[model samples]
Structures are given as C-alpha cells and as structure tokens.
Target: MIELGLPWVLATLPLPILAWRFLPRAKERRAGALRVPFFDEMIGSVRAGVLGRVKRFGAIAAMIGAWSAMVVAAAQPSWVGEPQSIPTQGRDLMLALDLSGSMAQQDFAVNDRPIDRLSIVKAVAKRFVEDREGDRLGLILFGSRAYLQTPLTTDRETVGQMLDEAELGLAGKETAIGDAIGLAVKRLGERTAEERVLVLLSDGASNAGVMDPIRAAEFARQAGIRIYTIGIGADTRAFGGLGLMSLGGGDSLDEETLRRVAETTGGNYFRATSTEGLIEVYRRIDELEPSEGRESHVRPMRALFHFPLGAAFVLSAMLVMAHVAGALGWNWTAGRGR
Candidate 1:
C-alpha cells in the first residue's frame, strides 16, 4: 500500500491558492502606449464559442495537474513494507581456542562414551556462538604459539569453519594461552572498550609462548578487555579403563592459570570435566553476557517521481497537439489587426 512519510505535509495543499491570493503583482511598466487600428472591431467578435471554452478549460486543467504533482512531492509518498530492526549493544567477541595435543585426550564423556576434549569444546562453543546472534565474533586457534586463525568478523559461519578445521597440534604440541590472549587483544584493538571481549578455552597450561600468561592477562586488564577462560579437561577419576590400560586415566590440566586469566580481566573461569559440564558452562556464559541491546532504525523510503513525470509528458503532448491543430493562437483580433 502507498503511504505518506510526512502526512502532515498534506496540509500544504492549499498553498497554491494562498500564493494566488497573497502574491504581489508586478508593477506595470510606464512604456508609451501604442494605438491599434482595429481594436473596436476585434472586441465585437471576441465571443468565439466552443474553441474558446476548450482553451480556457484546458489551461485550468494543466495548472491543476502541475499543482497536484507539487503536493505529492511535498507529502513524500512511498510504498509501505515490513518493518526491520537490529540490536545496537552487542559486543565484539574473539574466541581464542586451544588446539594443543592434550585436547585430543578422550577423558571427557559424551553420551556415556569417552570423547576428545577438542570435540566437546567445539560442539559447545559453536552453540554459544550461534546464541549470540547479533555480536561480531572472530576465531583464533593456538597451541604452542598464538596466531590469528581467523580475524574479527561478523560471519559466524566462516569462524565456525576455522574452528572445525583446527587440528590438535596445528599451532604446536603445547598450548600457548598467553600468546592466544595477546593475539586476540591485537585483533580486538579496533573495538571499543565496552565492546571488546576474549573467550579462551584450553585443555592444558601455557608452556611454549614468548609472552607469559600472567603478563598477557595483565595486559588485557590494562586494555580494559574482559577474558572468559575455560579449562576443558577432566580430573584423573573422570576417565575409566575399558579392557586394558586407560589412556587418559591419569592426565592433568592447568586450572590455576586459566582462573588467574579470567580473574585478572574481571571475568569468570569455568571447568568442563564432562560434556554436560561444558554445555552448562556455555549456558552460564550466555546468562552473564546476554545478547540484548537497544535497537534503533530508520524506515526505508522509495521515490515515486516517475508517476508525475509521465503525466507531465502526456500533458506536454496534448499541448503540442492543440498547437499543431491551429486551435490555439486564433484570437479574434489577430488576423484583422495584423
């Protein structure tokens, strides 16, 4: 349906009449008047009949059409479609994932069967990303050295791919928790303080990085960046031996470093022992950082100038026909006076 954006502007429809009423007339020039020979004879035949009436009515109709065009322009008529809105307060988050060799440990249980830590983390983290519908999220995978696998972006699909493609020992055999945080901060430098966040998940401690984990956490705190840390490994008792020796029955994880990182940055630390625990951890994070924000928007408008433009062309064509038919310029006195 058609609608006017500024419907109040329709009140200006009487502007043309007001112009005709209040507009001042130009002063007549004081040029000397010239005498005409047949003025009296022209006055007698002035009542030309049908042609005269047609000329007068046609001129009035043309003026009315032009005025209608102006009124429509002022009212700003447009097509009304569905309304749209988007969140305005979501933060820019960077997911710093740990792909160290220990992440391959099948100590965590998923549906009563042992699963790798990386697999559990992947599933839970992907769900968390999906829940943050409006936030611009980025991915960074690290093991021994920290590197940005994927920069900050709004395309969650691409970030998910990068996360899925990450291998156990891609960055290295060891985890570089500090380097990952530093890399995330670098990428998040473009974002504002309130919008910047780093979420890091690791199954082991930082053992091989140029930057120290404590120092990195301090840097994040100084930069006003929040870091949510997750330790993704089960205790020794969480694993069981099936037939022979249990592989992950006696493995350990670095919870202290992860907790310190989170605390220093004014964020919380979570431990994911079982797959269910991982899901609950993600749910808690969601509650803490709810994806709610103020939304503001402008309604879109489409131009409709073509409708009046086509009418103007048709009117011009009619005026041309009238001139060509010799119906106009046949004033009663023109032939006699000339």
Candidate 2:
C-alpha cells in the first residue's frame, strides 16, 4: 500500500485555485508592436485570437496538472511492503565450546559410525541454534586461549557455520574454560542484566588458562550472567575389530568443577556421554529459558516521491515547450500578415 509522510501537504493543492479566484490580475505591460498601419486584417486575426485563447486555456490546464504533481511529490509518498516478523531483543546467549586436542576423540557415533566429539557438538548445537529463532546467539571456541568466533548476533546461520568449520587445537591444545567464561562475560556485559547467559561445554578440565574456572564463574555470577556447563565425552567406545579403546574419552571431564561453575551462576550442569546424551542435555537446557519473549515487526518501505517528482518535471517541461511553440507560431503568423 501507498502511504504519505506528510499528508498535510495535499492541502496546498487548492492554493493556486484560491489565489486565482481571489487575487486581482496584474496590469498588462504594453510592448512596441510591429503594427501594419495601412489596412486591418479580417479572417486571419480572428483565427489567431481564437488560437491564442485556446493556448491560454491549455497553459492553465497544464500549469494546474504540474502543480498537482509537485504537491503529491512533496507529500512524500511511499510504497510499504507487508509486515515482517522481527526477532526482538531476547537473551544474549553465548555458546562457549572447548577446542582442545581432546575434543578430537572419536568416542561419539552418528548412524553407528564413530565421529569426533567436536563433530557431535557441531551437529547437536546446530540444531539447538535453529530452534532458538528469537534469541541472539554467539560462539566461542576455546583451547589454551579463548577466541570469540562469532560475536553476539541474530544471524544464527553464521554462528552455526563457524562451529562447523572449527578445527581442533585452533587456540592450542588444553582447555581454557576460565578464559572462555571471562570473555563471554565481557562481551555480554553491555546487554540487559537479567538476559545475559553463557553456555560452556568442555570434554576436559580447565588446565591451561590463567584464570581459575571457579573464580571466573563467580565473576560471571556477579555480572548477572548465568552459565550452563556441559561435560561431553563417552566413557567407553570400541575403536576397531582388534580391541576396544578403553577409558575412551570421558575420563578427563571434570564434573565437580563444571557443577560448581553451574551452581555459582544459578545454572545447571549436564553430562553427555554420547551424541544422544548431548542432544538430551541441550533439550534440558532449552526448557530452562525464562520465556519465549516478545517480538517486534516492521514493513520495508520504498520512497515513491521520485516517481511523482519526475512526473512534475516532465509536465512543467511540456508546458514550457508548448508556450514556446505557440509564441513562435504567433510570431510567424504576425510576420506573414505583412
């Protein structure tokens, strides 16, 4: 539909008419004429007079049309598109995943084939991100150091893509859970207090960062940021036909520290021993949200003033050309009468 930014501008449309009706005409200025003083012309002068009057009427009509077009343009017409749902400012949730060398363990399976822990994380977390339509999501890949792969954004696809493309030992081997939590807190500090959240997942303990995991969780809690800790890795899995890779990967998972981090930040800690367990843990985390939250919407608008503005210009130009042509015709006729 078309809308006007300044509807009041249309009221000026009748101003020309009002002035023409109420105002007195200006006195005509006399000009030296090439008069034929010998004899007066009959049929031709009358014809020229009639043509002049017709031209005058045409000019008046064209002037009004141009004015109307200009007024419509001035009113600022716009074409508004259908309303689209805008995801309102929901939770500023950051997902911090471990990128240590241990995450490369092939203890998790997909379709009965063993896959690395990080692959399982990327798969399940991609699903989690898809379901969170209204929330802003971020990604942090931490090893010996923390790296914010994706900042807080409504573009969940970018976050998921970043997760999928992540490699092991990107920030060096050994988990830096504390640094990851600290970075999340820093990034989420500017957001609304009650809505800040961090979900940290690691297969092993925080053994390589400068900050202690427990202390970082306390700092996060103080900053009104809740942290959900996910400990992921299977306890056992058979590697090949020869024998089993005993104590597969879950041995290094520091459950006690993860639990303390979750408890300190008023959040929960979940243990995922397989791909299915990781999916279920994420499901449980999904149920912990405060609300679905509110959503706002807007229509895309395109300014259509230029269309009518161009029309106004064209009409004015045509009128000017017509007046010029009529003047030239009158001059030619006057000269021919000699």
Candidate 3:
C-alpha cells in the first residue's frame, strides 16, 4: 500500500479552488496588426456540443493534474515503516577462569560421569556466555599469573574459541585468584560503572600472584565494579579401600576469601561441588547483574500522500498526449512568433 509522510499537507489541495473563488481575474486582451476585432470570429464562435464542452473541461483537468502532482511532492510521500529499532543495552562482563593443576581433578560429574573441574567450567561457562546475549563479554585465564585471553567483545564465537583452547596452567600451575580479580577490575573500569561486572571462577585460593584477593576486591570496589566469586571444588574426601585413591584431595577453595572479595565489591559468592551446581551458580549471578536499561520514546507514524502524486502523474501524461492531438487547442509554436 502507498503512503504519505505528511498527510496534513493534503489540506492545501483545495487551494486552487479558493484562489479561483476569491482572487481577482485579469482581463484578457489581444493585439495584432492583421487581426479582426470581432471576438467571436477570432476566438472561434461558441459551439455548444459534446466535443466542445469536453475540450473546455480538458484545460481544467490538466490544471488539476499539474496541481495534484505539486501537492504530492509537497506532501513528501515515502516508503514508511522500513526502519525499526531493537532493544539494545546490556551489561559488560569480565570472566576470569582459574587454570591451575588442581583444575584437572576429575571429581566433578556431568551426566553421572566424572569430568575434570576445568572441563565442567568450560562447558558451564560456554552456556553462561551464550545466555548473555547483547552484553559485552571478556575472558581472563590465570594460574600462577594472569593473562587477558579475550578482550571485551560482543563476538561470542571468538570468546568460545579462547575458552576451548585454554589449557590447564596456561599462566602456570598455581592459582592467582587475586591477580585475576585485579585484571578483571582493571579492564572493567574502562566501561560504564553501572554495568561493569567481574565473574571469577576458581577451585583454589590465591597463592602465586603479587596482588592479594582482598586488595584486588578493594580496587574493584573503588572502581564501582562488582565481583562475583565462585568456589568450584569440594573438600577432600577419603574411602577405606580406596586409601585416598585420588579423591582429588588436598586442593581447597578459599571460600572465606572469595566471600570477602564478593562482599567488598557488593557482589555474591557461590560454591559449586558438582557441574550442575556450577551451572546454577552462574545462573544466579546472571540474575544479580541483569542486562537492564531504560527504553526511549519512539514517535508513532502514518503515511498517506501517494494518491495525489499518482493522480498528478497520470493526469499530466494525459494532458501532454491530449495537447499533442489538438484536444485542448494549445499551440506553443503558433503563439510564439507574434
């Protein structure tokens, strides 16, 4: 369906009628050297017939057509409703993952089968990342040191690739939980304070980095960045016959430090002994740092100007053809020389 942007412009359509009714008409006069003074003889005697009346109305129709075209142009007809806006604002999140040797422990279960803690972390983190659509996400991998594996980006595929290729102890074999938090804080500080968030997932305490966990959390707090900490492993457990058959024992997660880090930054701490629990923990964090924003007002619209434009073009075309056929008695060359 055709549409016009400024329908109010159509109110000017009857302008020509108003001009005809109220405007003073100019007296028409003719001057010539070899011409007769009889108006009937020169202008053609009045002929009352169907064709005569039709020819008289032809000028009116052509004028109407031309005026209609002008009206359509003034109305600014357009193909409206082609453009649209979508809900767009989202939070900026930095994900810091621990890559220490203890992350290799196969104490975590997926589908009732034992999987390494890092493996579960990867799987659950991928899901969590997928859930954060429209949000800018960053990744940090840490062990003895910390490294920015992926800078803040909206591209989920690249972040996923970085997570997949991440090896245990990519930074080293010791957990630098504090350094990871510090790195996250540093990166998130560059973004909007209200939307900046740091999510740190680790199975061990900080023991190999220059920054302590509490100090890093303080820095994050000062920057108005929230830090959500997840302690990702269970305490040591032993069986009689197993004789400590590698229950993934000895490695421990510093929940107190993690909780303090979260509290200091007005974030939360979660524990995940199993893979399912890890998925739930991330979901809870998602709830805390929601992708929220206020929506702006959009102007409502309607279009209705194409009718006059189309009518004008069709009428103008008919007028040209009619004048060519002498239907309106218009003669450009005949009226020019004299």
Compare the candidates by lDDT and give the number of the best one: 2
Off by over 4 Å in 3: 1-83, 235-251, 292-338
**How would the candidate models be sorted by TM-score, starting from the highest?**
3, 1, 2
Worst 10 residues of 3 by lDDT: 238-247
Candidate 2, poorest ten consecutive residues by summed lDDT: 238-247
Residues forming the 10-long window of minimal summed lDDT in candidate 1: 240-249
Model 3 pairs in collision: 4-303, 4-304, 4-305
Instruction: Report residue 18 deviation for candidate 1 (angstroms).
Output: 42
Q: Which ranges of candidate 2 are over 4 A from the true structure?
A: 1-87, 237-249, 290-338
Per-candidate TM vs. native? 0.59, 0.58, 0.60
The parts of candidate 1 lying over 4 Å away from their true place are: 1-87, 238-251, 293-338
In order, candidate lDDTs are 0.74, 0.83, 0.77
What is the number of residue pairs that collide in model 1?
0
Candidate 3 per-residue lDDT, tens place, 189-217, comes to: 88863678889888787899999999999
Which ranking of candidates, highest lDDT first?
A: 2, 3, 1
TM-score for candidate 2, residues paired by index: 0.58
On a 0 to 1 TM-score scale, where does candidate 3 land against the true structure?
0.60
Per residue, candidate 1 scores C-alpha lDDT tens digits across 194-307 of 767888887776788888888998988888888998776665664432311112323456677778888999999887667776788788878887765436565566767567
